[model samples]
Target: MDPAVLREDMVDGLESATKDVLQDEAVAVAMRDVPRHEFFDDERLAYADREHEVLGTRVLSPRTVARVLQALALEDDDSVLIVGAGVGYTAAVVAELVGATNVHAVDISRPIVIEARQNLERAGYDGVLVDCRDGAQGFPEYAPFDRILLEAAAVEPPRAVLEQLSADGRLVFPRGSQRQRLEAISATGDRTRFEAVSFAPLLVDGEQSGTLERNRMAREDREHAVRRAESRRGWEQDWIEWEHSVSSR
Candidate 1:
């Protein structure tokens, strides 16, 4: 069967299961347009409505992707920061909605980030920046994002991510150490909880060490990461304020 047909069927299942998730026309369109199969080697599992493990990471189910996109409520010109990019399927979908140049995806796993970049480029979404870095920091160079998405579950939505949101922006992630519940937060700090969801726990800096047979990052990419790290040091003051704000909540 054509992957497009498979994608449509996937969306159909999503819509039938939870109409609220596909209520956003743009989200539905992007979900249908992005080639989900391109990100998966297992064609059968790609079309299934369940999470599939890929390269030590989990490609979130179509249902979860749809809900995250719907919660984001992205606009065409919006800039987005996506954490836990996995193999970039969710980033690809978001790129279709907000345009490729407006999206940035980051992951702590170096091999996974490399795979995500390759997958996205092969899928013709090379414009979306995929970075290998600590997702907890939330990409400060791209601060004030219109939307932020976290595919991994955390004890709480990182305040750093909330700080990245522009005024009136939306952030979505599953929260809880165990028994996570998907939640959406407004830029103003109001949070709304939704259905229970499961995801790998968000790992930070040293906690993300892993060996997956991929070689070290290319020299140029390594240099870029170093540069970003240097700049990140300057964001510490802003991080302090964000931390204080969340502490009050």
Candidate 2:
């Protein structure tokens, strides 16, 4: 089936599954415009009402994305900050609701950030800015955003990121580690809680623990190789000296 058709069908399923998710025409339109298939390799699952892992992060189901976007109540002129942008699908949807220029997406994974930038561009959202950074800190340069969406689970809202919101901004995120609740916070600190959902922990600045351990091991291997080379050179020197002495005798 054509991707556009599949996308429309997916939105339809989302609207049907969730009570009033696609009531907003903007969100409905955006969901239709952004081709979900461009974000993932599996075209079959692209429009399915299921989640897939992309770049080590979850590409949330259309139902969840619709629910979050609907809860956000985005405006065309609103500036959006999307944390944990996985392959840029959600960002593209937001860009469609708002103008592409009004969206700034940040992800801690550099490779994922690069992939998202490429995906957005490929999907014709060239104006969206996808950056590799600590999403927990938010994009300070683009502070005062009209809305902020966290695609990962956090134990609590990061004050730094929350501070970046505009006076009337709204922020949505899944809270807790083992068990999570989707919490929506208003600029004035009013909060609304939704149903439980599981999401990966939010990543922060600094080398990832796994990457750090791998780097340490690589450094140790290099050091061991250098020591072995030096030892071999010492042995070679000894052999040369003995040969010279023997020849002289």
Candidate 3:
């Protein structure tokens, strides 16, 4: 069982007229070359065309990856950012198309980010930057990406992500909360919609896995909350204090 041949067969099924999920030759080659097994404990499942759970994130299946890359229509040397870099497989494939250094990815879950980084490194795409951050915010430090892909679904494109796109850049995402569809939007606001798809909702601060604290809070804020909770004036406030309610009445 050669992994290379498995990759070839896997992609072949995707390209066959019956499924026809793959059309972009570049993406097909990249999928063939990137060692997808590096991201999985069982190499057999790596080429099975099914989703795997990695650190609470669902890795994109190959057909989904193909559909995304086709929508992106990437060109060489194009800078790309991937939100929700689960296991880093998609980012690695993208690295093949546009060089590893040109790829950047961010994830809201720190554990997932770490997993993605490790997987990318093992897959020899160490040049790709994987960071822990809110996906909706995007990797703005590398602002103005030539292309952006949000693997998670959202009701609409996050405004901050849109802001990070280069004027000529385009973003691909699954839109909607319950009924998601693939969509691409240009920086100038032009949009294109494609086939229906399903993806987990994008997570925000405080909602990320393993977090129990409120979002956007400083250490000072947490300390203040603790102090307030321990103090008396009852440690809790009503919608209207008794005195204030009487005065207003």
Worst 10 residues of 1 by lDDT: 240-249
The estimated TM-scores of all candidates read: 0.80, 0.80, 0.84
Clashing pairs in 3: none
Candidate 2 runs further than 4 Å off = 17-21, 207-249
Rank list by lDDT: 3, 1, 2
- lDDT assessment of candidate 2: 0.78
- Identify the candidate with maximal lDDT: 3
The whole-model lDDT of each prediction reads: 0.79, 0.78, 0.83
The segments of candidate 1 whose C-alpha lies over 4 angstroms from its true place after superposition are 17-21, 209-249
**Which is the better candidate, 2 or 3, if ranked by TM-score?**
3
lDDT of 3: 0.83
Candidate 1 per-residue lDDT over residues 7-85, each given as its tens digit: 8988887777555456677788888888888888876789898888777687888888887777777887899999998
For each candidate, C-alpha RMSD in Å?
10.8, 11.9, 8.4
Clash number by candidate, in order: 0, 0, 0
C-alpha lDDT of residue 148 in model 3: 96
Per-residue lDDT over 1-249 for candidate 3, one digit per residue giving the tens place of the 0 to 100 score? 999999999999999999999988899999999999999999999999888787767888889989988999899999999988889999999999999999999987778888888989998999999998877688878998999999888877778889999989999999887798999999999999999998877766435543332223234434644454346364344321221122122
> Which residue pairs clash in candidate 2?
none
